[model samples]
Target: MAPTIPGFDYQRVQVADGIALNTAVGGSGSPIVLLHGFPQTHLMWRHVAAALAADHTVICPDLRGYGASDKPADPDGVSYAKRTMAADVVALARALGHERFALAGHDRGALVAMRAGLDHPAAITLLACLDVLPTLDMWQVLRGTSATVGFHLYLMAQPPGLPEQLIAAAPDAFFGHFLDIWSQRPEAITPDVRAAYLDACRAAVPSIVADYRASAGIDVAHDQADRDAGNQLRMPVTVLQQDWGALLGFDARALWSAWAPDLAHTTVNCGHFMAEEAPEQITAELRKLMAR
Candidate 1:
């Protein structure tokens, strides 16, 4: 039940990594890649990407493991690190023939984009992070009562077999729980949309688990290495987040500025799923970020 959106051409482009990325392209101008968050696909960017396509060539692709992309086996022999995921974006943009482009991502995608900016600074002209904090700082802030808000962090962080076993036993309940709690306007996610999302989650359980599991282990090592190297985004950064003060009890803007020196942070009264909940606001921020 994908929404019948007008003027989008579904496409698949093969990158150097031997994975063909399933992407949707629309509009016509400078390329701006849009990456989706956890438990969602490029469909999450359908509204915002379509809106931006009026002027900018918007590229919405499912990240490697999540949607219609190749879900290769996760052996430690191959890297499942977000750094490698970031490199996938680099390879993807290069494969699409864009040398320098504007990039943006939400939730888990934001983490990948952040790594892209730090790792491949010259390749990105602008960066936008929607509704996420740095992984390391986020872990630090998850102490005391605030920790309860992100119980899934620990749930997904556990060693392999147990989490996968439990979550697979009740995939809908596991994914649906987040879809239910994360949105301020859960009503925005109609039955059809919810069903589609749950279906994608159920299909990609091991990859999804591996992605989060990396965040808990390998990704943390990467973040700490960057921190040790005194690295930062080093580009104009825009952050849009729902005010989580009542829930997480941390100042979003203050924490963000520490990582991004040239930053513009705005708090929107949306849910954790801000892109779908407030597409207009998110688009406005993207336009402004591009103009900056």
Candidate 2:
């Protein structure tokens, strides 16, 4: 059986025609939906969700193309677009009876949340993004040797067939690479959680690759259009990120501020998997964000 969030009830909710998200809903009161990052399932929020559940209705979902969620074939390039995934998130919340809710996402899910904040501004009352830059700023800042840190981003962004075949041949090693190294507190994931993540990623290789490919192409274009139009997040936004800016040669605050006028950007010391490595800190940060 897949490892799950303690005290959380799991269900499959239809977010789009023929696409239902595997979601875990817990707690009570105001709603806050947490979206998981790449190489992870909703289980990544195991610690934070439980804490937030105390005073809020916490929703966690395996995004389409990841975990137990439906992975529809992406024949058209836009299928796995962040816009599409953002729409899935909005739909998931609406299906769960939340017309407006707080939103938080880690990594790839953060990208989707960012898009949702721009596209469906009125629906998201508060926004929190964990450890990532908006797509357009991300591409703009990654340059020279500093860019080597994101080799997987470029690898998966390649044309469809090759990326899928290469990753499928060694799914464990490929997905495990991220799960193994991205955390300072590796023990936070535990063995069962690691197994669950690898299993999910292995089973959803094609769709996962398509999702990354979309980030490189259509996702970037969408962000650019939003930027060109002077659009910004309409809600109170909080960003908890590793201090990767100096290494990558860019100011995370400046980049994020361009998009979020009411922003709380913090430089965290935890590893890439901050939600797991520093759940206490993250949980505190999230509570602070929601309180705003």
Candidate 3:
């Protein structure tokens, strides 16, 4: 059985043609949509969702190609692009009767949230991105030895066939690598949760690869066009990330400032899986963002 968020109801929401996102809706008051990251599902928001349920309607959804969402194999990688995924999120929120909502995302979901903020500024009142840089800056910072930490990004960005075959061969190990190496508190992700993520990734190998591949190709083009056009996220934005800037020798705040005019960027003292390793802090920061 899939892990359930307390007091939340699960449903499959069709955001695009033949593409439905498996979503969890709970709480009341102002709506806030939370998007989960790679190799995981909405179950990752269990703790934070319950905490925010007291005053906010929390909508947690698996990205279109992850978790229980429909996995469409688009060879061109267009279907899984963050822009399309962002549209899915907006449609999902609108389908739930929310024309405007606060948005928050972690890891891969952060990429989606960023695009949504850029593309549908009217729909997202406030945006919070956790543990990821913008797509363009992300690729820019990855060079030489730094790229080593992001081997999976390059691997999946390949011509498709090989990454799917290799990951499919040992899905658990491939997916579990992030769970093991990225978490400050691995125990926060119980065995059942780990198994659930692995199972989801195993079943959606092609779609997952296509999603990442799009990042290196079409997603970059979209982001670059936005940059060249001087298009920015015209909303109050908050970003929470580990202090990787110190290690990577780049100015995180300076990078984000170009995209968000109204920005609050902070480096958290947690692992990449901040939502799990430090739920209390993540919850507090999100609540603060929504309040703003």
Which predicted model would earn the best TM-score?
2
Candidate closest to the true structure, highest lDDT: 2
Model 2 per-residue lDDT tens digits across residues 174-250: 99999878888888889999999999999999999999999999999999999899999989999999998989999
**After superposition, which runs of candidate 2 have C-alpha atoms over 4 Å from their true positions?**
none
What TM-score fits each model? Answer: 0.95, 0.99, 0.98
lDDT of 3 by residue, 1-292 (tens): 8678878999999999899999999989999999999878888889999999899999999898898889887956699899999999999999999999999999899999999999999999999999998999989988878678899999999996899999999988999998999988899999988888888888989988998999999999999999999999999999998998866778889999999999999889988888888999999998888878
Taken over the whole model, the C-alpha lDDT of each candidate is: 0.85, 0.94, 0.92
Each prediction's Cα RMSD? 1.5, 0.7, 0.8
Full candidate order by lDDT, most accurate first = 2, 3, 1
Q: Is 2 or 3 the stronger prediction by lDDT?
A: 2
Model 3's alpha-carbon lDDT is 0.92
